[model samples]
Target: MQMRVSDEDRERTAQQLQHAFSEGRLNQLELEDRLEIALTAKTYGDLLGLVTDLPAEHAPPVPEVVELDSKNGNIKRSGDWSVPRRMRVTSKYGSVELDLSEAVIAHSVVEIELALDYGSAKIILPEGASVNVDAFRSDWGRTATSEVPGRPRPGHLSVVVSGKTKYGGLTVRYPRKRWFTH
Candidate 1:
């Protein structure tokens, strides 16, 4: 059976090439060539050549799960951490914060399931991350999201947030970049 390639697959391959370039693994010309091939790839096999010589992405030691109970303390995860395919965040009288600026997201789309009860949750994403609040239900609570004002790029990561909040607040904030910086 032939495997079809998705846009996300192409995007991820390109992103891997970009990372290799940033890490000095590939020269400018080689990086450009690989990126072109990745973006134009039509099947999974086509992307294999670009990452054949590179190191593989490693998964976290444990199942990627972040949980916060009724501890009443602040919970934070940031800086080069592996983002799991599914993230479950539950806060009872506590605050939860997730920073994805420097995170290593292995997937094109991440699912965040939040359960807040009399607490607050905040997600801080990078300047170009795409976020969608598919479903949000709050009882006497509030939810607000501020995203990067542009259509999602092909090689960008997107986040999907869902779940419920009762007497709690959920906020998603993205970085505001300067004109000089991309």
Candidate 2:
């Protein structure tokens, strides 16, 4: 598929990350990790990768790519092969079935927008993945590091969530890096 990274996404990610870095919210390790993610991100998939390793309570809202016309997808660049796909995860929160992983992308580093209705959310990436997310106007997210994975480990568990949060919040966690972490 074909995807285009908008100037808005680029600018937004840069500013948020710059603010995080300036505010000492990220340690040296975290700073480097985000920078790597930012640099490696070309398509939306690479940008989405940046949000994979966060805690469940801080996932940003993902836009409704499904509603977009596919005509705007998969425009082959000089050397483009694959496009990013959606990974939707649904969960039962009390009585309502919430799509927790609706905005979830596997490997992205660009800027993402999330809509939150209740609590806070965040994203945890690898050694070199940076993400910037605006969760509406109320919810906020801070950086976190951990050794645990989010989704169920019965299979290759990749989790995702975005927009219209109803309960506690959202978080995405990347796997443990045998090599390095950011």
Q: Per-prediction TM-score, please?
A: 0.59, 0.29
Model 2 per-residue lDDT tens digits across residues 63-121: 43422121212211122122134422222222112222232344342222344333434
lDDT of each: 0.72, 0.39
Model 1, 38: alpha-carbon shift in Å? Answer: 37
lDDT per residue as tens, model 1, 49-136: 5786887751102234444444567767778666767788777778878888888777887788888877777888876677877576
> Candidate 2: where is the Cα deviation over 4 Å?
53-61, 67-182
Clashing pairs in 1: none
What local lDDT does model 2 show for residue 78?
21
Q: Positional deviation of 121 in candidate 1, in angstroms?
A: 1.1
